[model samples]
Target: MTVGSRRGQATESLRQLTEAVRTESSDGARLVANIADNPICRVTVDTGIPCVVLAWGSYATSAQLRFVHECALDLLRRHALHKILGDDSALAVIPVDDQGWLREDWFPRALEAGLKAAASKCPNGFFGKQSVANVMSGAPVGITVRSFEQLDEAKAWLQTVKI
Candidate 1:
């Protein structure tokens, strides 16, 4: 998963990006394409990996969850697209900020949803645990980065690991 966006841009409103995941293959490569969209999250899955680049301080609310559900469906569709792409490695990449999730209760629910989605998408239900191992192995996915600087570092760390 790689993240990139234009700098110093502000959004009109804050929204949440949440999704559900389903993997069609046990051996597939999932690459998350996290777009730098504000207000509404713009998530793209090139493979099964759903990469998301969100605004710094966007908030998640009950109304926002509906949007999350929609995103989830889109994420699943992208995973299916992975089958066509001919990549057979199952993986999930989630982006979040500690400031966004810890500051608000609503955010955690969305985060949980993302976690669940990632886990469910794993072919053997072992990808989630494997990701945890990856994290502890000096790299981590589904990690909460505090700022873009840290985000960049996290991305670098993630790049070291093969999906």
Candidate 2:
């Protein structure tokens, strides 16, 4: 897809919510940690030069979701540093589901839990709902979503995203 081209509605919407700030590059390597505001609290991990939607989605509860969303800024800071330190590693992406965000008054707790799971499994790139569920279910690493209609875009983005 061309830059600025609108393809998938969800992907496009997520992109619109993200704002890139403070980009850094050294020796052909790039690091960007940007603040993203979406329907849910989110941290996008689009480093490694491929640009992936590392983390997206908001929590269900407004208050807790807001708190988690706010915390995403902090998370971004840490994520940036992590990427800077771990050069040549793939990014991780975690897209929380809307149901989890809405049905539970546990967004903050869930976010913390989810973030921990994602970070641990970040060695593996990309995660879908099932993968995330499994991580929450006690797996060491989050599951990776293996199928997508737009496989090329999905994979390309997945490579740059970290949970």
Off by over 4 Å in 2: 1-59, 81-155, 158-163
lDDT for model 1 comes to 0.29
TM-score of 2: 0.22
Tens digit of per-residue lDDT, candidate 1, span 41-141: 33344332333322212323333323433444344444432110101122222223322322243233334334212221121225423533343233123
Worst 10 residues of 2 by lDDT: 21-30
After superposition on all C-alphas, the RMSD of every candidate to the true structure, in Å, is 16.9, 15.0
Tally clashing residue pairs in candidate 2.
12
How far off is residue 27 in model 2, in Å? 44
**Model 1 Cα displacement at 44 (Å)?**
4.1
- Record all residue pairs in model 1 with backbone atoms less than 3 Å apart, i.e. clashing: 19-72, 20-72, 27-88, 27-89, 28-88, 28-89, 29-89, 32-51, 135-139
The TM-score leader among the candidates is 1
lDDT of candidate 2 at residue 32, scale 0 to 100: 23
Candidate 2 C-alpha lDDT tens digits along 1-163: 5433533652453343332212112210111232344333233555553221334332223233233333443444455422211111122333344335422423333343343222222223334434444433442233223323343444554555564
